[model samples]
Target: MTDSLQNLVSPEEWQARIDLAAAYRLVALYGWDDLIFTHISIKIPGTEHFLINPYGMMFEEITASSLVKINLSGEKVSESPYPVNPAGFTIHSCVHAARHDAQCVMHTHSINGVSVSAQKNGVLPLSQQSFFVLSSLAYHDYEGVALLEDEKPRLVHDLGDKRFLMLRNHGLLTVGSSVAEAFLGMYIFEATCMIQVRAQSGGGELVLIPQKILDMAPAQITQVTLGMGGSLAWPALLRKLDRVNPGYRS
Candidate 1:
């Protein structure tokens, strides 16, 4: 099943599969996977077609050729031995339809992320990490496991043009023009939530970043990364993945 996929797909799509597969493994590496529940999807460049994980496979077990290619309608468009998850289909398809710029969409159910989502205020600007999230964050109230097709519009509306979404009482989602960008977004997002959780556990007065600094976070981040955004860190992350989980490109 895996060996023949390379011959079947364009080089561009093969690369997309490899990168998306790497993302799935990295999510597992970072302890964000939820037993095949959450998903990370990426569109094949210049097409409505996208790749998602083979349903029921653990993230670490995913390989580039193992990803299932499908259209926005949740129907498989290529040959694969695995089925697609309906819940994953429901969430990712709408985001892809609404935001063409979102080439990749990643979702997670990490403890810290869910913990913050369960909070009423959601993603407070208590740390520097939180600023990036707060600047472009939106919240969507969980509508009982994300299975219904009717929930798609509401999900798209709440997401709007934001890069980060806190699925209230559920988890976190981030979208980007590339898998690297989306992974970096999730890194910052999870880190922010972890910081928030740790700070709250201290039981002391949390000093919020002043509104002035918070307002400048977008520029500050651009300056810090020299406008590289996720591309700056993606190579290093891939190198890390190569060392730890090297078969993602298979």
Candidate 2:
């Protein structure tokens, strides 16, 4: 790491690196990784820059040092031997710029996520986990690959005031003030999609939650963690990641 990188890497940044890398490992372990397609990015400590996985690295191969630093404009800031996907950063940059509270943003193209996004109804409130997502979910129509600068405004508009975004015919996205929150949101969002897929496969009557009950879900889930929020799930997830792929932290 260079002196500038050393200065940028605070205790918080170290923790973020570990958490973000673990998330990538866990996503790969769960078979949710799309080779090198999806991305999970975290804002660097004390700067407008963010850390993203190297363009060509598999999710399981991502380490703290393997991550690349890039500005919101998608310019690489550090002397990384690895290249970055500026087009991949397009969606992430929009969220980072629009949502100041969003310290981390995760995007995935899992089979389940794509299946759910392709559905006409999007996310249905069939499971308890669905409530947590449906309460705060936003939907963005797919405009092919997310590369055009013009897509940013529409993406921002669709993602407005929501933490979870379902990119229609594309995949899923979640944002949080911390890496943990973003990961947890993706977890629930993914779970909801998986459940919906399996349920539809059975061709059985779906038990959808009432809209009134769904409306109360966000507050209720928040209350369970006492406003510390997804940090409750973060520790346990780290423990799981450590057992499966401990190299990510290093």
Candidate 3:
């Protein structure tokens, strides 16, 4: 489908496609994709439009040229032989509408993520990675399968100025200024959930991080990650993908 459009889009839009497609591939690589159920979206550079996975394709099967471009209204801007899940658009559009900083929005129904979401405590600060998440985390109570337009306001309200969101009884969500940041944030968020779940299995008292330390996390995060930013590790990830399955870049 993207074959004929190669001469149609600007270079920047095409690059957005490659990176966004890489994100989908990475999600599948880490087993976060919910068998074509969950969605990840990226706003096109210098435009109000965004690119999302074509409905009905497995994450691993998604290619750069095959991504569907849509406006804030969930209407398609690109020609494609696929349909999109309105539920996916409903959730993504709301957040994109409110958060100007979030160029990429990623949602996952990973097992560990949903496990922690259902917990009354939500995300706990039991692991080192949890600190970074807690520094910018928010929680939204689940309100069914994300199809209603009215629910958009509440979801954006709960997500106010936050990068990480735990949808109670649903799953995990991360928004980023870029695709790499969103993917990296989800990686940590999912890992934190996995660690917390395993820690609870021993039935031992969970020693929580002190509030003072949590307060310092927002400032120390760059130092902790050595100022790599989110995309620092992205090249390595893409290289890894290339070794295993390079078709996503097509």
Candidate 4:
């Protein structure tokens, strides 16, 4: 590891690393991971730094020790043999910089996510799963692979004051104050898209929930789940990951 990472490894940082690694593994297990393409990153505790997956490793191969420490500019603060991906960090860094409440940022290019993103209406309120996402979601049109520095302002602008962002014709993103929150947000977002896609495939009129009801969805969802959607779901996902790929924590 780099001296920067050596000095940075505290209890909180280790926890962040382990949780982020577990998230990567779990996303892979759920089929949300797109090879080594998409990324999930967590802010380094007590610093402006963040932890991200190394460039070449598949999600299942990401151990806590393997995650690279990087700053907003995407330079690897960790002394790993692997390099960091500047393109991947571009999307993540914009959210982290714009949303101080966001400690973890998860992005994915899953087929379901891309499918929904391509639709002109974006995320329609077609299911219960859609309510959780529609209440606080935003959309950003794809700018041809997210590598340009010029795109940051518009991307952040489109994501203003929202936890979830659907990249038009691209993929999905969720930001949270904790890894669990971000992971759970993505879970709900992906489920909404999957359900919509499956429902549309039925070739019948979608039973979209009314706008008035959708307006009350955030509170209603909280009431139904007792605000434990993340708290409850995250552990179960971890257990699933443990069964399939327990080395993430190591």
Best by lDDT: 1
Return the clash pairs for model 2, or none: none
Model 1 weakest 10-residue run by lDDT:
220-229
Error of 4 at 147 (Å): 1.3
The root-mean-square deviation over C-alpha atoms between each candidate and the true structure, in angstroms, is 1.2, 2.3, 1.4, 2.3
Kindly indicate the candidate among 2 and 4 with the higher lDDT.
4
lDDT of each: 0.91, 0.87, 0.89, 0.89
Clashing pairs in 4: 2-79
What digit string (tens of lDDT, one per residue) describes model 2 on residues 18-119? 778788998898888999998999998788889999888999988876788899988899788889999999999999999998899999999999999999
Residue 236 error, candidate 4, Å:
2.1
TM-score of each: 0.97, 0.94, 0.96, 0.95
lDDT of 3 by residue, 49-92 (tens): 98998999999989988899899988897678889776788889
Write down the RMSD of candidate 3 (Cα, Å).
Answer: 1.4
Predicted candidate 4 versus true structure: per-residue lDDT over 120-147, tens digit per residue: 9999889888988999999998779888
Winner of 1 and 3 under lDDT: 1
Off by over 4 Å in 2: 1-8, 227-229
